[model samples]
Target: MTTTDRRPMYWEEFSPDSARAGAELACLRRGVGREPGNVPEMWRFHRVRISDHEARTGAPSASLTAEHAALTLFAVHQQSQRKSMHRQGMGLGASLRLLRQSEKYKKNPQALNARVNALATSADVPELAYHLRGLITQLRGIGQPLDYTSLFYDVLAWHSPEGQERTRRRWGAQYYDWAESKAKQPQTD
Candidate 1:
């Protein structure tokens, strides 16, 4: 049975069978055409906002389009990432806010991160963080949050059934980090 304060399952934790199971699960998740169906409708609707606005108001004729938005979002995301790679955690809050803005894109934060992790396996963790940071930055510039509640760490734990394992791993690390920091604090007695 799993304990309440169980640790994250890293490469070190998997048994032979469990490792195979994990690989199988990863394959299933990565299979062609496997899209997350429960992604919020608001995200879908947000994509249409630019086109919808263009149609109704005839603005940004030369400056805005879906592609523009996507690029701008990417650029902002990249900028934020540069900041993060320097060991700055303060930008996390702002970066998350940006992601919330770009929620309209086909992929949400979790999906995007998973994709990046899969495709960019050789990339350093700091590099990945930079990418995510850029995404958040772009989203925020356009007036959106990185969507903490909908895309938060805690939400991951309870939301997707498949995500639970990964979420657990991530949360375990986060909790451990927090606990370690707390443990190092001096008592004021």
Candidate 2:
């Protein structure tokens, strides 16, 4: 039983502004300034958000939206590329450590997680989902089973499926199966 074992099982609540600030802070801690937009993934999220907002409010600011969209695309693309570089055999602790070593992740790792989780819930839901799936796949390849739903609930404050119930179902099923198997086995001397 370590400190992690004693931490809260889950956290609930989502605040968009908090998430945005956390993200900026995370980057600053990593020694990186506000990243410029230039990648497809980041751009997609920005585009989705801008479009959604514009549709809702009938605001017409194509130039501003385009600029922000470009910046976001670059950021997400860079992150994905970075994740691929370190994916093999890296655990959460290792990843966190690596991130912290950089100027961008010096602050609370949990907070960074929340920021990333929030980014994933940005307007382009499908793109975020695909990118996350790839990241999770890479983590899994390294023998890590990322509990993303739990992570999102604990860290991010974005409008998206929290996946809490799904996580519970998976955990319960796995735990029960393990328990049943253990009960059926003869005791080892």
Candidate 3:
């Protein structure tokens, strides 16, 4: 089926109750830092989907690139974890925000902030992926989860200038808006 006809099966769909979920995640993990189509092992998991997507478009698939990046990052983030890392509605910005708020980083946030700034300032996919690997590692250290599906779409959008601006704006809002909303909440005795 084409990408438009069916959404790619992400980690969230695999129930944690089954071993298949862990096995699939393990397959994806092997692709970390490797170029798409280079890892023959991961091809079974992602190749057919990408081929279907490309077939429909009749051109190189941007979504496939984004999918590879997001999948690899998810594998990293989910490493050694019992629960699924793909939390719905948890975007990259929100995940980073949680990392920023973690007690470990609360005392000294400069390094965390610097990493985030680097990610924000990345000019292209390769640069973004490089920066993301570091941040994703940090998030894993803190046991934070993110929505890989949302991240896939965001990364795809990042391919175009207009989409990149919009994605950046949305991420900024997600990152900074959380504090404002929390501050506005009514205090109770």
Name the best candidate (by TM-score): 3
Question: Which RMSD does model 1 reach against the true structure?
Answer: 18.5
lDDT order of candidates, top first:
3, 2, 1
What lDDT would each prediction earn against the true structure? 0.34, 0.35, 0.78
The number of clashing residue pairs in model 2 is 16
lDDT measured at residue 40 in model 3 versus the true structure, 0 to 100 = 67
Q: What residue runs in model 1 are displaced by over 4 Å at the alpha carbon?
A: 1-123, 147-189
State the displacement of the C-alpha of residue 53, model 2, in Å, after optimal TM-score superposition: 24
Best by lDDT: 3
TM-score to native of every candidate shown: 0.21, 0.22, 0.82
- Tens-digit lDDT track for model 1 on 112-140? 45533442332332233345444444554
Query: Candidate 3 clashing pairs?
Result: none
Over 1-189, each residue of candidate 3 has an lDDT whose tens digit, in order, gives: 344665555665655667676777788888877776567667665632556656676554677678788878887887777777788899889988888889978888787878888888889887888899999888888888888878887888889999888888888888766446656989888
> In lDDT terms, how accurate is model 2?
0.35
In model 1, how large is the Cα lDDT of residue 54? 58
User: Which ranges of candidate 3 are over 4 A from the true structure?
Assistant: 1-4, 20-23, 47-60, 178-189
